[model samples]
Target: MTEPAGRPPAFRIADLIVAEGPEGAERILIAGLTVTVSAGEIVAVLADDTGSAAALIQVLAGRRRAQYGAIDAGGAGRSRRIRPSLPAGVSVVAAHERCPDGPAHVVVVDATGTRPAESGAKPAHAAARRGGAVLLVTTDAEVAASADRTVHLNRAPRPERRPKAAVRFTTQALREAAAGSLTAAGVDAERAALVARVLVDADVRGHFSHGVGLLPMYLDRLRQGGIDPTAEPEWSQEEGSVVRLDARGGFGQVAADLAAERCAERAARTGLAAVAVRGNNHVGMLAAYREHFVRHGVVGLVLNVSGPSVAAPGAGRPTLGNDAVCMVVPRAGGSPLVVDFATGTVASGKIRHAAHRGERVPANWLVDREGRPTTDPEELDRGGAVPVFGGYKGLGVAVITEVLAGILAGGTVSPLVHKQRAEPERAMDCSQLFLALSPDAFGNPPVEELLDVLSGAVAAGYPQGPPEVHLPEQQERLAETMAAEHGVPVPASVVEQLGWGAVRTAPATAGGTA
Candidate 1:
């Protein structure tokens, strides 16, 4: 039986070959045996010899490498060999061994000499009943008959091609298209333009995860009532140098803009001001909000909290969100110094992007539901979580972010915040904290002198001259400059999904790599 319409195969082995003996004199035991197993289906591989079946099983278990071909398990990208440890959701059961106790999505059973095939077939069927696929390698005729489908070892098939290249669009064209798409989805024209600007700005700075790639998600949220485009951020409370704003489930970009503006205005009078925003949705990128402070000539510090996607140290499950922190300092005679990052090893969006492109990620970036290190990007959707960047130190920063953005702002935290992508119909109810400090309050300290001293320290530290020591925001500025001259490149899949294919331009050679 075939899998459900929109579902991908549980595992697929294409053009796989098993060989034995010396280098050139090696003999092909199993030549290009292709097998595709759908979820909840039992597939039997009928091999000519016991050695061939054993070899194939070894390859599947990651104990031996295949001579050729690719394996894709659980839609995690194709690879020539499985990692030292098998991919997530896959398990191997040896002949005469009982099936493992836990829940595995795919089970590979070696039943080469099982009698009557009833014992082997029974366990395979049981595994399928639990919503898992079973691959039974056996020469027994009964075993082949019991399977949902059978593959012969002699059949060889071709491998599929990789994903297509990204489509390119000029910055103006992409911003216009993104704004139009948002406006069509019920966002006000002004808000749509603002949102578009923030997203495109992130893209030009080489932050694709927060760039135009989020337009589709924002549009979805607009349609589902997760984001209230018509609502405006309003000051809810005020004190000497502290204020609170309620977004009322409005777009995060709008909330962030208003908060930054208010903070800067209040700081001008009070020397330092803090603004807390509650009931906001996903803020594209914190750096984008720094522009408001930059224009107002104030130093800015921003923090935001979201639903949990990062695991705390020594914990198996996610205990905190991969919250973000950003600070921007306007220099006297140069570009602003901006530092922005998530507390986790990587942002959750990076893994999501990898999954969208059918690519694998580094094992250290994520842990499966059982807390096992995995390279499968899809594991994020299966209860996996990203770990803190530098272990305990990063965890400390993340906790501080939660306290400032969630607790102090009186907004929903971790388990309380609805997932933006998973539950688009519901509001995220995340929070943000914005702080503005005026250098004029301190009689205008010599910021340029401080920067020069830092540069000099870098030179002195490395007698041979530091290997291109980069100041904060230096790389981002260079990327943005190049993107302005050339065009922004977006994934073809994303453009097609957003119906902006018509705006695509020729690929550009300049600009930061994606």
Candidate 2:
């Protein structure tokens, strides 16, 4: 399509992190990059990582998830996050090669770092005059330099890998090892097994941060009686399509599992059900609960609030929990579409892992006590906080979780949930919200066909990575298979945390006897 002649489209691009790739293998496509285009200007975004640049363009133009900015009370800037599914009529301009084509509110100019700057800059200039913004996403510095305004997205370089052999254990042995650790920590038979399964399940699914690595945290909390070892969940409300549960300071997973069970049962009957949970310890990962409903042929949403460890935009304090959210929907013949993430740019566990390994964290992930950005993981221990992902975008999601899971569940929100200088204590009053819905509740159309179509459309794009889309559920399935077939690889760090005390901290693959 030729460039249109009119005034530029009024749009502002801020630091956003809506980009997604293969699980665990994801890298920063764009760092804290912000670009703003006024009434008659063309902004060229240049980044070393083209993947991030393209993803950013798609998300802004409503090609990806439709939410932008922080989860503040009023509304985050310029963007909005949609739950479950994108609205009808929502379409992403399909990209050809690395360039996008077709009609869109914003037009893209794909100039591959080659050619004289004037060749492509002329049309973009013409488009802006016609009241349409031309987004030139290029790696060519010259092309970027010629735009009316140029934004340099300082994307962090991918973390360098220190190759070490993986340490493997039979799936059965891995389960036992995890369960044994909990049991040794004084957890009862059933309880230990339940928690162990979740931890191992996370590792099995490649979410090591939420997996066995958290065992020490659980043990510490339970040992100190910070979490009541035998506490039981009691239903506080069981009204139609809505319920509330008090966890009684017990293991977070137990209450979460119960909530998922009850919600799925109620949703099947009522078509929609919600359960507000309060007074539980840390729930490892919400994915376990969300996927449960998917197995029951429904959609599930889990929002959890914990200690305030996330910094909000414009706030001088770390007043928000990295509050987590997970959503799962059946993909018909394939894996469930499990979307799970915390509001933080990176999980706190990862920072701890970096500290343990003497590795530098990505700059955007941490801010020290002085409120300055840092790459040192040790800053976390010295009173640093995980920054909200994409600034306002992440805070907005955290706010949603804060309201639904904390306040609505009768628990404390952010600033109140955590004290700045207080010593670490087991968070016993954290809250969670579980919502489940029958697919038929909306339109009752053929879900299998709908998903198949969507899945096919994604496949048509030939996205990178194994199994293409890398749906969380799909990743979990693959992880489970690998665990069963090749055994689970327990990191040396995890082994050390398990009280083994002297295991080497390098990766070495090992397996139980055949």
Query: Where does candidate 2 stray beyond 4 Å?
Result: 1-166, 314-317, 418-426, 459-478, 501-514
* Model 1 lDDT tens row, 1-514: 5434654578777656566653312456666566777677788877666667667767776777765566667653543433443455555654432224411112463232122323366778877766676788775666677888877665434442256677767777778888999988877899999999999888888787788888888888888888888988888897767899998898888988988888987887778999999988888889998767777788999998888889987566877888999998887556788999988778888777666565556655677797755656789889999887777998889889989988998556766788898899988999999999998898988876887898778668876766542456766877777676667767777887898867746356744322
Clashing pairs in 1: none
Which 10 consecutive residues of model 1 have the lowest summed lDDT?
97-106
* Candidate 2 local lDDT, 1-514, one digit each (tens): 2222453334444444443443323444444454545444567767666665566555544556522231111112443233323223122222322534221122343222122223245656665565444556666677677677666665445654453444676655666777887777777889888887777677777676677777776777766667677888999888866799999888888888999988887887789999998877777877866556866788888888777777877443466777888888876666777888888877777777666555566656777786655666788777788878766776777778788888887567755553212423555577888988897788787877777787677666654633633344666777767666666676666576676543222223433321
Worst 10 residues of 2 by lDDT: 66-75
Whole-model alpha-carbon lDDT for candidate 1: 0.75
Local distance difference test values of all predictions, in order: 0.75, 0.64
